[model samples]
Target: MSGPGPARPRLLGCDFSSTPSRRKPIVLAWGRCEGNTVMLEALERFPTLSAWTGRLAQVPAWIGGFDFPFGLPREFVIAQGWPLDWAGCMATYTALGRAELRERFVAFCAARPVGGKFAHRAADRPAGSSPSMKWVNPPVAWMMHAGVPGLLAAGAWLPGQGGVVGAPRVALEAYPGLVARDLLGARSYKSDERAKQTPQRQAARVELLHRLGAGEGRLGLRLQAPDALGQVFVDDASGDALDAALCLMLAAWGEARAESEGPGFGLPARMDPLEGWIVGA
Candidate 1:
């Protein structure tokens, strides 16, 4: 019998925590695709940013979907008189201390009227993502402040940011809630609060997994999970595991598109470089 050929390239999706610790870690859901099927191979947990960044720097030849904004809204960037170019903006952004960043953002939000305090990126409209500058009630702004620079330092090529030539790793912005909503129709799946981890959400998780395995979504990609791995997804009350799986599927979808449609990982032609697009939205 012929020996197995080289292993298929893998794809990854990460559910990140801005403040990670032993109790709450950055979770990576990784897998490979075979035709229309995505096999969720493993879950990696990094309890600190250093550990996570090390993985990002060393890992090669994979497409990853991460749950953090790749860029802030162009309008917001412009208003702050920051660099118009993605690269410059990133450089300027990553240089600031978190306290200064937070103070600036808070002041910006406070000056605006109610119901219009936060500026939105173009991708936010379709993806239904929160404004990347919002510091409260999800605090995705901090996530971006903490996450994107690490990705760049790791030498991961961002599609909208002139894409590093010949770089093996491609990073795309992802939001698991977007995919979850597409499948389960606004049913809540995971919650950080112990009080909110209801049975309803648990059932929703199982149902979503079953639907994904059956290839019942926009990408038409099936999920393959053995019983042991499947239980791992269900048992996590915080939903980090489930979110990572959803992101992994999105990465697989983008990979399939890259093969058929010639790179860009299926992102739109007119996407804003200053405000990166979410992979599937």
Candidate 2:
């Protein structure tokens, strides 16, 4: 990690995958923020959720912005008769096996009319994110099912959920797409297929890094990195590296907001813990 600065905790940004594997690992970008600069010091990948959680348990202090849904929509929870509070809802939601959960979610969606099959969290519309209840397409529901429990198990403080003041490691919800779109609009930046990973996408990544380094875009924090490291962000066709960097910058922005505005780290004061807010939304 980079050297500490401003007495603030180190920053982390994670791009998560449900059912993480060696082929599509969960990527974590970690660094430090100094003044207006967010320096990305390292990138790590974990092949499994357990490995990621175990690594998190060892960190002494950090403020992380993870690319996963922190909670389900309140409407869905209420309709399903789940607990209303965040902790209780998570407990009730996580108890079921994935198969059972999928079955129930599928049924719920099937019963709804077209264009409204999935219920949405308040943050979804604002962040332009997928509905947390959708099991297919992105499988973000499963990501939530797999990811949040690990944060809880690792004893990381979840803002607006159950975080205590001065908690060693604070975890917040973040969306890299928000930052990416803010800067690059709808330009494609990544592809999982080798054939589809064209030079244009690589160029998009390069342009993104350049702009981010130059402190252009919504987060208002510059990315500080060596030239070679900037190349590293572009060479990966999966776009995981650049996405992680975007998330890291968002973390820095959140820290700045917390320092200026009160606590809550750029999240809205009225955010619902049951349906967590996106960090920069």
Clashing pairs in 1: none
Over the stretch 1-281, how does candidate 1's per-residue lDDT look in tens digits?
Answer: 99997555679999998889888999998888999999988999999998998998877678899998988888778878999999889889878887898888878888889999888988888888889888777889888888887787788888867457547788889989888888898799888999998999899999999999899978789999778879988888899988988889889988888889987888998898888899889
Off by over 4 Å in 1: 1-8
Point out the worst 10-residue segment of candidate 1 by lDDT: 160-169
RMSD of candidate 1 to the truth, in angstroms, is 2.2
Clashing pairs in 2: none
Q: Where does candidate 2 have its weakest 10-residue lDDT segment?
A: 159-168
Q: Over the stretch 50-168, how does candidate 2's per-residue lDDT look in tens digits?
A: 99999888887888888889899898898899989998999888898889888888888889999899889999998999999888877888898999899888888887887454587
Q: Cα deviation of 115 in candidate 2 (Å)?
A: 1.2
What TM-score does structure 1 among the candidates reach?
A: 0.95
Instruction: Report how far off residue 277 is in candidate 1 (Å).
Output: 0.4
lDDT (CA) for every model shown?
A: 0.86, 0.87
Candidate 2: regions farther than 4 A off: 1-7, 163-166
